[model samples]
Each structure stands twice: as C-alpha cells, then as structure tokens.
Target: MPDYEPIVGRYLTIEVAGEACRIHVEEAGDGIPLVCLHTAGSDARQYRHLMCDPAITDHYRVIAFDMPWHGKSNPPVGWRDREYSLTTELYKDTIMAFCRAMELRHPVIMGCSMGGRVVLHLALEQADRFRAVIALEGADRLEPYYELDWLHRPDIHGGEVCAAIVSAQVAPQSPDEYRWETLWSYMQGGPGIFKGDLYFYWYDGHFDDRSPLIDTDKCPVYLLSGEYDSSCTPERTAATASRIAGAKATVMEGIGHFPMSENPALFRTYILPVLDEIRGAG
Candidate 1:
C-alpha cells in the first residue's frame, strides 16, 4: 500500500473575461468553503500545508487554484496575440466566476501578496458574495521597490531574477527547505507572467481611495502580515486595515512575505486563530 495525501487535484474549464480558460484546482477537507488565492507568479501549491492540515480541513474545505498562465493552468486561447497584464477588473472577475462555477455559497476567501490586495477589492465590491476574507501580506498600496521592467527583460533570465528578488523577502528564520521551495515556485513561472502579475501588484490594485469605502460590517476583513515582509510591510497592512471600519490586522513574527510557503509552522500559529474566529462567527 502507498501512503497518499488527502488532497485532490483537478482541472476546470471556465470562461473568464470572454476567454475560455482551463484552470488547475486542488482541494482538501470538507465544510464551509475556504477559497485560497496564491501569490503572483506562484500557484496553488503554496497552500499544500494548509490543505494537508487535518486541523483546518476538519472544519473547512480548503480550495486553491492556479490562475491561468501560472502553475499547471493553461493560458487562454490566442496567447501570442497580446501581452498579459493583470487588471483589478480581470482579477476580481476571475475570482467571481470561479466561485459561481463551483457553486460556493459565501465561501471564506484568503489571499497572499497580490492575491492579498485583491481580497480588499472584493471586500469592498463583492462583500455580499463572501462570508469573510483573510489578506496575508497585503496592503492598499505598495511603493515600487524594484524595477518591474527587469522581470521580463530578454537580457535577464526571468526565472533567476524573480527567484533572486523574492529570496530576500523570505525571513532568515524560515527553514531552508521551505524557503528554497518557495523560491523554486518563482523560478517556474512562465515568461512575462511575473511581470504581468506585478502590473496589478504595483499599480492597478492600490486601494488608497477605495479602501475607506469598504463596509466590513457586510463582510469581515482580517489582514495579516509577516514581520519580515519588506514589500508589503506590516505597517502598510496595519495602515490599510485602519482605513476600514471593523477590519482586524495582525503581524506574524519570524515570518516573511510568503508565510504559507516560506514558514508554514509559524504562519499557522497566527492563521489558526483567525480561522477559528471565522468558524466561530459562522
């Protein structure tokens, strides 16, 4: 007999932004849906530990999907015709479409980094559709710390550059095995895809003007930032949370930007309480 994980992987074809996209999805456990969104240039693999944890799966269904052009998901038809740039509308629409397609009723959504920022957008625009939202390493705005253009330059190796830049964002305290695993995901991103994802991360996703408009009473918002995350600093996340009425913010010690992947053990110490709160609320 072979030891196997409880996680299940599958593909779903859904029409997003007028294009039929085949998305790679993985899920585990059972109960209220807990939809997870991965960081830019990475995939659902980031949440492997979360899905495998019986503590979480025992009370919640953990669902994660690789956005088109990332992970094992295939790009929409006619990829050569144009550049891929992620916009706020496109990101929100994709999530909405996926939830509808899956028939998830008021699922609790959680996202990290780029996915984190967008959850703010959802909390503002689509609050009625979700039971709650957890934003990890997220903020309303992030100043450009590195050259986005360098990510896709023909002269630079896209994977190497991306991996190198994110390497510093991982906390020094993180286990070497998990830290390298996080970087390996960056190295696997498709050409120009990392740059494209940053389009939203750096520019389109900022919610400085809109964040204050979020009605947390409609849907609860929880923002958590890793202490070592320089890109979306803990200060930034706390500031963003301050703008929204009733939003909560927390800082995970000894963790970094990619908490779920970079340091799962510590990340859980912070996340489990939030999950319990949501569960209790439900």
Candidate 2:
C-alpha cells in the first residue's frame, strides 16, 4: 500500500491572459525550481506525497496547478474550443503564461500522463524555458493504441461508462481513494470539456512530426513507465527518449499505468534520483 498524505496548502488565484485561475501552490525548500503537473482529470494535489518528500522538496521549490475546468479552477469561456482546455496546445500556452504570472524562473518540469504531453509540447515550443522534463505515462502520439480506440467506441456505451466512472469518482472511500476519485471526477466534466478532450485525443495531428518538439542538444529529458502499463510501453517510451538528444527512460518494477498513484514509493525512488542528478549538473 502506498503511504498517503493529503496536502494542506493555500490557494492563489493568478491572472493568465486576463483570466483568473485558482491554483494550489505550496512553497517547499529552496534550490532549483520544480513544477509538478498532473495527468488529465486530476488536480495539482496528485503530487502531494512527492511535494512533501524531503528528498525532493528539500532541494527544490515545488509548485503544481489544477488545469482549468478541473479541481478548483474555473473553465475558460471558450471551453469548447477544439483544443482541450485542461491539456492541449492552448493549455500549454497558458502554462507559460501562468509561470510568467508567478515570476518563476526556468524550472525542471515533471508531468504525468496528459501533463507529460503538455510538458513535451512546451519543450518543443520553447526548449530554453525548461532545463529538463520528466514524463510519466505520457505519450508523444495521440492515438497510442490502435485496437482499443479509447476515445470512440460506439459499441461500448460511452454514456453509461462515463456515468459509472463519474459516480465512483464522486464517492471515494478514503483519502487515497478520494485522490483517485477526484481525478475521475475531473474527467467527467461538462459535455464541452469532455468532448473537446476526446476530439484532441483521437485526431490531434500535432505529434505527427516529433523532431521539432524534442530538443536535440539543449533540454535533458527522462521518461518513466510502469512495467504493466498498457497505455504506454517501455519500448515506445525508450524510443521516444532515444530521439531526444540527452534523454533516458525506465519502467517501474511491478506497476501499471498510474505509477505515481499506485506505487508512489517506487515512483519517488526512481524519479528523485534523476531530479538530483539534473540539479547537481545544473
């Protein structure tokens, strides 16, 4: 069982592109800057344990935010835009905007799942702004799995599935369960948010050309996966790491798609070391 500690932090609303978003920011330690980004449908609290870990916080200023339309953040007026408000090109732009609003310097980004995709997007768009990136369970391709078609499956009863998922999300049994459920609840946003994310998940063509997004010599990158992760294979992630000039990859021993949530101790063990190495090099 993973040790759990719910984060008790203050909420700060920052203006980004004229819109105010309520973000959960915790100031921990003081050395290199570390920004933790959660998977889609989850809030910044997903990194609660990591943020509290002395191994990590003792050496970095950690900050995380709930993507718009998720957690306590307000959604954009144009929430139905083709790009997903929570995790997309537009969201990545907002990330930079948010960082600027906070006056944060170049930070090492650690993003999980959809958050990883956002980090990758930023790395491609502005490599200099980020010193390094740690991607967990994130994919470079939109349609990573061919046969499942997670986005659209007329035969699987989408509404029913989403409803059940939503209910489970809202009715968590414990703190840990609440963390997991909170994530699912975010996924069950209004039709516009959900549909918008679905569209991008299935048809986004931005990742077709990968070279431009990955830095050949500047940014240091690392990819982490769970041994049993079906969403992203170690081989695929390794190949992605191979493409980026100074990137490395690894898989957590006996875990699945959500290593941070499922096996956090192991997740921290492997990830903290890499962060230390990067900070030392810096």
Candidate 3:
C-alpha cells in the first residue's frame, strides 16, 4: 500500500506583499527545495501528498504555503478594503518576498491553476532565480472566460458555484471520496476572491502572443495538463509549451483541474517521472 502518513511543519508568520501573514507550511526530507504553490483562492494543503510521500521527500525539501487571504493566512488590512485584484505584479512580488523570507535558494517551483499560470512571468523575467518550474493546468491564456456575477448576488451562496465549477472540471473517474477535499479551498474562498483571481487567470496574467518574453535559456519549463480540464485543455497547454523553445509538455490521462488533489497517488505516477528527469539533469 502507498504511504499515507501525514507530514508536519510550522505555521509561521512571514512578511509577504508588505503584510505579516501567517502561512501554513509543511515539509519532509532534505535536498533541493521544492516550493509548491496552490491554485487561485486555494491554499498549500493541496500538496499534502507530495509533502508526505517518503519517496519524494527523501530527496526534496517540499514547502507549501497558503497565500495571504487564501487559507489559514491572515489577509492584510489592505486586502480587506476590497482591493482583491491579483495582478501579475502582486503575484511575483509576493513570491520573491516570500522566498527572501524563507531563505530558499535555487528551488524548483511547482504550481497548479493560478499558481501554475503566474509563474510564467517568473520564468521569463527572473529565470536565474530557480532551477526550473512545473506548471499544471497552465496555458498562455485560459479561454471560455467566465462571468461570475451570480456569485456576488445578495442571496446566492457563492461556495456552491465554486463546487459546481470544480465538479465540472474534475474527471468522473477521479476518486469520488477525494472530490470534497479538492473543493475545500474554493468553498472557503473569500467573497469575490475567486472571481478576482479569475480576472488574472483569464486576462492580466495571460501570456498569449507574448512568446518573445520567455527565456527558457535560463530556467527549464515543464507544462502538465489534465485530460479532464476543460478550462485549460491539453492541446492549449501543449501549444503554449511549444511556443517556448525548451519547454516540455505532457497530458495526465484520467485527471482533471486539481491534479495533485484530485488524487495524489495517481498524480504522482506522472509527477515522479518529471522530477526524476529533473534530478537526472542535475
């Protein structure tokens, strides 16, 4: 049977984006640092399987943090003032600030959804900062952009909308038991936070027609998409990867939007190969 033991770590307060936010972080093993970033309006808990896997932890110092205002992290006063927009600038600034706070060096960054898409900016601008990046359900730009006006109405429950979206994106063959766990972040998202995040996912954070901005010469890029992800199809992700000279793309069959959380045991089947290759390269 696969190891199901839980990994433990600290809920430390770190200054990110000019605010003292308490980030929930978990880790295992020691070697190269692997920083896991969560999806939009989600937290680091999605990476529990990777953090706890003895095989992965044996070589990687896996660290996952909840974004300020997303999980257990406290939202700064500025964010509470309804300044919920997540621009590319805010995203990268927080990442750098967080990295500085953690003193991580040459770490490999891996993320999904919003976490996956925003890092394209980093790979392009500050390629030398990290060894590589793995993006899941990522694309230059996610189309079929949605309008979430109903979520903001006075009487409707927004979490249900989130649940519906997650349900629709996740493959039916995915473990039925894990579906709720995958919805936890979206269900718990702050009002307008999910919608605000989509603004960046579909627009400001977009990389469409901007291939010239990328420089894979400095850092390696790997793009992974799920077979069930309708929002960011595998074809789109592969096309995006093709635009970059050295980037690699792969499709995770029988998976969906929340690849890690959809079923980590299954997700690892594909993830390990990529990590192993990265390790071999080094």
lDDT of 1 at 113: 96
- Candidate 1: misplaced stretches above 4 Å? none
By descending TM-score, how would the candidates be arranged? 1, 3, 2
Least accurate stretch of 10 residues (summed lDDT) in model 1? 144-153
Residue lDDT tens for model 2, 1-282: 767443445666766667776665655656788888765544576676677788877788788777666656667566555454333555676678767766788898888766666667667777899888878866676453333233235675543454344333221222465345444544454434444444444455235367345773577777787666555567657666666656677877665555665456667788878888888877
lDDT (CA) for every model shown? 0.93, 0.63, 0.81
Task: Say which candidate scores most in lDDT.
Answer: 1
Steric clash count of candidate 1: 0
lDDT of 3 at 16: 60
Q: Tell me model 2's lDDT, rounded to 2 decimals.
A: 0.63
Model 1 reaches what TM-score against the true structure? 0.99
Indicate whether candidate 1 or candidate 2 has the larger lDDT: 1
- Candidate 3 regions exceeding 4 Å error are 1-6
- Between prediction 1 and prediction 3, which has the larger TM-score? 1
* TM-scores for candidates 1 onward, in order: 0.99, 0.77, 0.93
